[model samples]
Target: MFCERSSGDVQKEDKSSSVAVILCFFGEQQQGGVSDEAEPFMGSGRFGKSPTSPLHHVKVVSSPFHVALKVNFLCQLFIRLWPDGRNLQLHFRSRLSLPLFTGGKVEGEQGAAIHIVLLDVNTGHVVTSGPESTIKLDVVVLEGDFNNEDDEGWTEEEFESHVVKEREGKRPLLTGDLQVTLKEGVGTLGELTFTDNSSWIRSRKFRLGLKVASGFCEGIRVGEAKTEAFTIKDHRGELYKKHYPPALNDDVWRLEKIGKDGSFHKRLNKSGIFTVEDFVRLVVRDSQKLRTILSSGMSNKMWDALIEHAKTCAMSGKLYVYYADDTRNVGVVFNSIYELSGLITGEQYLLSDSLSDSQKVQKWLIYTKNWFDFDH
Candidate 1:
């Protein structure tokens, strides 16, 4: 399970603020006690031995903040987890309302707007319920206007106006902020338990519910969301935080430590490779220089370490590095080469920067090879 929140103030009305929250779960559950061999034949041959069961008893609640505004709403959807399996239910509840101008003008709207959507990863079935009744979850905001006079078909304004009218009833603003809760447990097949010596203990069971508050705004541009995951356990022994040095070959340790202690920077500086700015210039001048240094067969152990570090940094969203001359320096001076390469290549990386880099490089990499999109 995971939870995330977006940054920046959500604008609903000129005076109101808002934010968005997202929660996700890795649905893992066991149902029928089919053996490994017979399992493959249980539900036709399509899924092989995979068991299908609904994520039952899903519940959602709205936040008091929204309720205070007299904006209350709820929506529920039943999605099939398997071809013939029970339906996994999802519920969304919110208590916010769409602001109305004295007349019907939508201009000068500056408040935040919030929207929530649920997607079934297994089947890619998405169910969205919000206050903006006319907005489709797939395409919430209109990007630009179309010129009707020049075009042969319907004009852009007419088309958009039609779309707006068609979707006015389904807009998210009509629903409000949503509160979601989920309950998962063993089914009629019976619960399975593993014991240490003699006690028969039931499997760890619990439910999760979350309330996300976000501001809503016009122009549905993409924004970043943050999330976290945690577990509650009841163990007998006293738990203690432990820090262990990475094994000689552990790539994660290698990457985190790279240039962290200024060792690499110091080495480069000693060899006349001054600041990160200089490094960036060198990379732009000759990308192979840094690659040669990193890929050179100096020590198998060190090479392995660097590779591992890079991978770890890529996964952890910590690929960006910063350098500043003093406390007063406001802008970031340096970033990880791995991150830069990912952006330049158009593949998804853990981090990306726009101000310091050129969009042409980004576009070129995205069109040419696989580069990481950190935001993705």
Candidate 2:
């Protein structure tokens, strides 16, 4: 058997071989917001490698800290476990690319907004009910490298308990304080704006540090959470030129095409469907996945309507009254909208200045009357 010492050193646990042993899974308070590699966990005490030994849950110390594995798998009788920190996990994530549009955004020029949220950390399960939770948000913006060893940079936490420690000597990235109420009892809204006196920062890398207050879960006082640092840059027209906007609005949940039932959307998130583009891809690529998008169930009529809705959104912003033509589905698109506008309205009526307005109307009426009589 083997165990992890509090000093973070791992060695053989020869003394505790006869008895089951538990190791404290303590994660270091990371400063840079980068993805830190957690130490390896070896099973012991009726766990780890011996199915005949015994079976029980392995409780970890940190409660709610996140650990990302490069290539991991769980097998039949082998298991490692931890308390879910009373289900409090901040949703702050490591963002690689941030783009901007008119609706609002996280990265780009000034006047963009930063949205905050707290999720009952999903460990491959759908948490349908949200607690009467309230999260206090405070963001600190830094001009340079936030991960410097000497500085106590941003720490990502969802609970209120650890937020005080993170903000002890830190400065915020935004100009002023911020807060808001979440309808689902887990999210809020805030804009990213600096005070007028703050100098222009058109060409600098800024790290978004966040802290959230802890809330109650099943009568136990759960601790707060610090999220991973999200790096936002002021790209100054560089990001806009290369990037393309998504088919749907940035806030995919608020879309009308998807029903407003909150539980339905929650299931979508659990299935790795966040954006409409992600949802559309699933519906178009696989029929079974589309029918099963709702955990409860959806009728074929509703499913077909949504699939058509998604395809309409994908091809063009406007919805068209036509079925998908699989035979001629592939195509080369042109700027035919403007080119056909003259034909649609009649090119002669548009340019003939000698014809009076009434005469033009009469000509169109006479031609339409004759055309409709024969066509009908």
- List ranges where model 2 is wrong by over 4 Å: 1-87, 92-114, 123-132, 142-173, 181-183, 195-203, 214-340, 344-376
The number of clashing residue pairs in model 1 is 52
For all candidates, the clash counts are: 52, 18
Give per-residue CA lDDT, model 2, range 151-201, as digits (tens): 333333222222221233434434434554444545534544432211233
Give candidate 2's TM-score: 0.29
Query: What shift in Å separates residue 41 of candidate 2 from its native position after superposition?
Result: 19
Question: Among all windows of ten consecutive residues in candidate 1, which has the lowest summed lDDT?
Answer: 185-194
State the lDDT of candidate 1 residue by residue for 116-160, as single tens digits. Answer: 334333464442333221222222112123221333333223434
Candidate 2 overall lDDT versus native: 0.38
Query: Looking at model 2, which ten-residue stretch has the lowest summed lDDT?
Result: 334-343
Q: Pick the candidate with the highest lDDT.
A: 2
Per-model CA lDDT versus the true structure = 0.28, 0.38
The clash number for model 2 is 18
User: What value does the lDDT take at residue 153 in candidate 1?
Assistant: 36
